[model samples]
Target: MAKLAESNNLVGRVGNAGDTAVGATAGIRLRKSLPWCAAAILGLVGVVYRAILIAVDVPPANSDEGTAGLAALHIGEGRDWPTFFYGQDYMGTFYSYLAAPLVQVFGTHWWTLRLPALVMYAVFLLLVFRLTRTLYSSWFAVFVTAVLAFGSDRVVKDQIIGAGGYSDVATAVAGLMLASALLVLRPEKPRTMLVVWGGLAGYIVWTHWLALPYVAAAVLLVAWVGRAGMTLRRVSLAVCGFLLGAAPLIVFNLRPGRPDSFSVLLSLSGATEPAAWSDRLHGAVLVGLPLSSGLCAPSHCATWQLWWGPTYLVLLVAATAVAVAAFRRADGGGRRVHAGRLALVAGAAMTLAAYVASSSSAMTPVESARYLHYGLVSLPAVLWPLWVGAASVVGKVGSGTSGDHGGIRRRVTGPSLGGAFLAAGCIALAGAFVVGLSVATGQLIAHRSDYAAQADDEQRLVDGLRTAGVSHVYSGYWTCNRLAYRSREQVRCAVLDEDLSPGLDRYRPYRDQVRGSARVAYVLPSSGTMSVNFARSTPALGVDVVSRYELGGYDVYLCRQRPERG
Candidate 1:
């Protein structure tokens, strides 16, 4: 019995030994691959979190989303792609055009529409990291990337893929990528970076109009400050690449059967008289910059402005102070590095200024978020250096010091103190993020019932419109789009553009076709155009409401042709 037991024990020991060897080998391999594994995991977590929000769907669908979705569907199904912004013909087509292929594959659903944002954000995160690592340190790069990936600004959340918000935010991020590229790859360096610069420029000019300013400002600033790096090879290559990127947009606009591209560009140049100097100043300082960063302000109220504007102001001030301090502290060669750092902040400010300076066609009394959504992209440029510099400076100064509690030494070392400062900064950011996310989630939860009823109501309204056999739909600028998009192209829909004085015949072809047609639906809000639709719609106009839908927010009116009085 003893001999048999010994034999079994020996076999067990051999098996245990084999398992240990395998685990040790894996441990060594994993250690070698730790960095890659960490990145993959972080990326996966961020993407999956965004995916979940997109999958669940919240904050309800807005008009901009509907416009993009329906237009994408129109393109996917091989109908006439919208030449410009839906209802407004002057806006760029790049956003809707890019999503058409994906909509073709995935159908006209939110997930497919938002998929591009997810992919783009991932790329955005990567580019930010690369840019930071090149300019700063890997540690700082990782820090900035984390804040962006996990930060919960309402603007970013609302603009995420499938949020169906305008394509401005996504394209603006692309613009920032181009700007960052320009900074990292100075044109005069005579490197391969100019090819990248030109290519990116082409994409920017051809994409969102809101984003063009960022890249433009970056190029001009960099070219001026980086005089040493400017070479003929770089200039030629950059310009050629820009032309290549811009070629498609130019060709598309110039095609035999296309909208007059020059007119669109000309119209965008702003008012003939230009905005009042006072209005321009107001917008640049109060409305444009603050609003662009997701700060809301009322015409008569300064309270909100005081709170939000200064918060960024403080950060910007810190960024400037740090840049100057760094420059003063650096030697001759190091001065260029600090100067570039300062230049980024200056470039961001200049971009903001130029955007504000552009004539605003903002029709509303209150500033709209769309006017400055691109600010979200420029934010990281200012934010990254602020955080990194604060941490580094604090770490350097505060390390090797301790509180004097009855002459008791805390035994703090420079490394430990520096780490604590970093931890503290990260924690503060994390806390703010948590609060923002929690508040957003709470809002979504509290309004869950309201949004639920809204969906049911919208679906019901869609069915009602179809049953009425309504062929044409035009609603208040905000209302027309979602219904039309949800109808799956069964009904033509639009919002009247700003320049409707040109007459119906000069507008989108369908508007002219629908005018005087037997069936038309008007989705009017309680205020504007409601009294006119009922009181002033003349008999000769042959317009009257057939059925009216009273929803929680607005009224949907289906019109009928009055019988002719012969």
Candidate 2:
């Protein structure tokens, strides 16, 4: 009886041990999957938020967006094919091509125009998560993803607005970073990564040259890490990939009569006649930083206080410092972190320098922050140091020993003190992000209604033009392409310069069609240059305003123009 009882107890013990083992395995699986689950949730939340904003028309449609939409419309109808944004030798038509099929299916609505940007943002978030996880810890990846999921209003607009190539630039930069990371981490076989990195680099060059600095940094990092893996054949494949990806740009530039995109890019960069470095640096540090950091009010950020600029500078400096320190003593994963972080810092620095030297910075520094938007791609690297420091401190504290000297001492060790400081820094970052979200929420609520109303007024103007039987007209830069897009070519408008003459005229065919018309109307805003130019310049150009009417904030004047002397 005693032997049987002992055997029963042993069986029960074995069963209990087996159950514990199963539970431990399950826990390990859960831990491994949790970060991925959180990342997906964050990405979904971001996409939904952007979708809601688009539905509400948060940023409102503009001429740039309208031009992109019009390109899509033309491509959809097989009317005309463009390699680049109409009237520009840069900013490839990839976005329009993406939207082409959608325009055909959905019939050129605002949502159809914006859906590509939404998709790009979703992909960008996923890339960001994957890249961060590869370079740092899962915990850091989740944190970075969360930071970007609900960014400030400026960041939101940069990500979601379908204005040609801005969102595409972000996605391309993330892709480049990821490919670079993979090449470094898996250098034994780097052919695929080399091709991917090259393709992304070529695509970004064609998509938006503003991201060139990032491409340069990515290329350098890949070369650094994959030095051993690179061979003549593999490198040739990468070259072929770049040639293939950049075929459109190469073909366009090669065609006779096409303006050199490189020249156009350089002219735009203020490189021809450089600004004073002092002023450029000041603008970059004060206005550009604040604008990109989402700390300044829109449209009038120049006049705001400079408090927001330092916050970004501090964060960047701290992260760069940590990266430099890590590189000096790196081994294994630390080397990868150092390389990734250094590349990001180099890219961001180059972007800032490019902006500072650009004519846009010299002219309208605050307003031209759109150029600096590419810096958003480097955010994961920027936060890596803080993440590592926190983890290191916590680990040291958790593994430390307590000692007694004389009486039992109640004191924190060096690791504990460091942990306290890291915790405080983390709290500050959280607080900053919370404040940014609050401001963004308030701005969205306040401005969404205003933009919707503006869109309505625009529609009213379009309706008035159609009712008046005005198919071809001339308007300011901001109103022309928008009118064309919203009217779906039922009404065509060409851009007029500040002097109310033929200007930019993105699609030359539109201008030609309008100029060929003997009868044209002047659609001028109630205020600003439209008002001043009409009252001052139109009469001088043999433009006779016969009849006039008002449509919301616009004034439409039906006019007849006499032929000009050659």
Model 2 weakest lDDT span, ten residues long: 398-407
Please provide, for model 1 over 1-566, each residue's C-alpha lDDT reduced to its tens digit, 9 standing for 90 to 100. Answer: 99999999999999999999999999977764554455556666667767766665543566677777777877778886655655554455556677889888866666677777777667766665555544444444555555554523244444573433244445444445545444444433445566666766676666555565556655754576555767787678778877876666777777787776557766764645456766655655555454444433222223444233445556666667876886686554344444545555664565555555566623231334345555555455566544553554344422111121122122323436656666576457535533443443444445556656766666667777788787676655555567656776676665553322222222255455556466677655555655355445535445675667764445667777633322
What residue runs in model 2 are displaced by over 4 Å at the alpha carbon? 1-11, 188-190, 274-276, 302-305, 388-426, 562-566
TM-score of each: 0.71, 0.91
Q: Which consecutive 10 residues in model 1 have the weakest lDDT in total?
A: 399-408
Candidate 1 has which clashing residue pairs, if any?
Answer: 65-164, 114-161, 114-162, 188-229, 188-230
Q: Tell me the deviation in Å of residue 443 in model 2.
A: 1.8
Question: What is the C-alpha local distance difference test score of each model?
Answer: 0.56, 0.76
Which one wins on lDDT? 2
Best by TM-score: 2
The Cα error of candidate 1 at residue 165, in Å, is: 9.9
